[model samples]
Target: MKKLAFIGLGNMGMPMARNLVQAGYYVYGLNRSKGKEKTFQELGGQAAESLSYIAENADVIMTCLPQPADVEQMLTGEEGLLQMNIKAPLIIDFSTVSPSLHTAIETKATEKGARYLDAPISGGTAGAEAGTLAIMCGGKKEVFEEAKPLFDVLGANITHAGPAGSGTKVKLINQYMVGMHTAAVGEALHLADQSGIDQSLVYSVLSNSFAQSKIFDRHYNDFISEDKDEPGFALELLLKDLGLAGEMAKESNASLKAGDLVRDLFENADTNGYGKKDMSVLYQYVKQQED
Candidate 1:
């Protein structure tokens, strides 16, 4: 059994680290915030004292941070992992960052005698808690094979996307669709409200029709119906992902005709105080828009 250290015990990371502990792994958890480490320790995970402690002791180091900069800091900051004299540890990243940054980090890891994998994940907080996330990995195939068992413990669907950065590329495309579909769901539901059709009726009918999507089900069933906007996935986070997708598209010279419009809608909504709310709050934002 490989000793593992998990950093960033936020919404997705805490549950993920907890799942590893439940599976009988001697997992060490570190968080920038204060209370989460205490919470993780209560769940049978060791609370790592510092990045140095993790670097010196952990056989495998995993990160599930929110942004590319956070990931980079964990590996490249003055007190970062790469600065420490770590053995040849396998590093797996579960953040949804850019392929360019992912590749850059892989190069840095290589210089430090560390193996790297870009293994961004999906399925939201529910999937993270349920241990059913879909993980897309990019790295050497042999390195991927060595990490498969750990991935198995964390996710239900895992795929080796290709070489370094390929996983983030695939994940960015997935986020592109996720943003588009989420915006469409808001628009459709708002249209239903404008037509004076009961929102539940619209959901019930469309859910079984060709118009249905997993995003629709998630937004309506989990958040909108209950009038709850707690952040299963934050609106701001989706906006960030949409921006990253747009950047990737520009780099690839791919034209996404509706991408800019959808991104603008989310941006306006986030600006209007929906940033901390569940992404499904886009429906409320759409409904409140001036006709």
Candidate 2:
């Protein structure tokens, strides 16, 4: 059995870890929240209080943290994974973080005989639940192939994009499109109301048009199916990803007028306390404009 240590047992991480355990890996999960750990244990995963224990014992260490700061704390903080005598060569990061930070961690991990991969994911909570995420990875070709089965268990479309940090670069492009489409959805809904068209009719018509997109489908899928709204991917996280897109554009000496414009729009909403809402509430941003 290949022992695995999975960190971050949040909405997305929990199911991902469960899949690995279901696939017959000896899975150990690390979570700061005791409740999360308890749930993981309930799902047949072992819980460890320390990253050291996970790093020391597991054959692979996978992280699904929220931010670059969290990733840094787990890798270099007290009782960090790097503090262990790592017999495992694979350390896969599933967070959407700065490419530079990913590069820095990869450099440091390589020095300690550990291979690192920046492998941010898409597919939202539904994808996590259905095990059909699109994973974009940046790492050496050999390491990526070696880890293919593990990613295959978690995602449907796994692309080994290129060398270190490139996965995150691809992630930024992905977010930029999402932001634009979300903003468009907001505007289209607002316009439909203004023109007195039935909301469902407009959506149905657009759903068949050339402008139709996965993002459009994403807006209606889960929340539409449930008739109630919950945060699968929160607005704050999308706002953060948009900000990263702005930064990425600047670093590449590329102009991101549209991305920056969308970031500013999301920032405005977040500033007004809508940060924790579903990103589809971009409709509210349009509402604010009408008011």
Reference-based lDDT, each prediction: 0.92, 0.85
Best by the lDDT measure: 1
lDDT, residue 67, candidate 2 = 75
lDDT of 2 at 80: 69
How does model 1 score by TM-score?
Answer: 0.98
lDDT of 2 by residue, 1-291 (tens): 788899999889999999988888888888879899899899999988577677777778999998778998888666667766777558999999999988888888888899899999999887887889999999889989989999999999999999889999999899989999988887887888899997788778988998788877777565533443467888899998988888898899999777777888888888887778888877776777888
- TM-score of each predicted structure versus truth: 0.98, 0.96
lDDT of model 2 at position 242: 89
Error of 2 at 176 (Å): 0.9
The C-alpha local distance difference test score for the whole of candidate 2 amounts to: 0.85
lDDT of 1 by residue, 47-133 (tens): 998888889889999999988789888987777898898867999999988888888888889999899999999999999999999
Count of clashes in candidate 1: 0
Model 2: lDDT of residue 152: 90
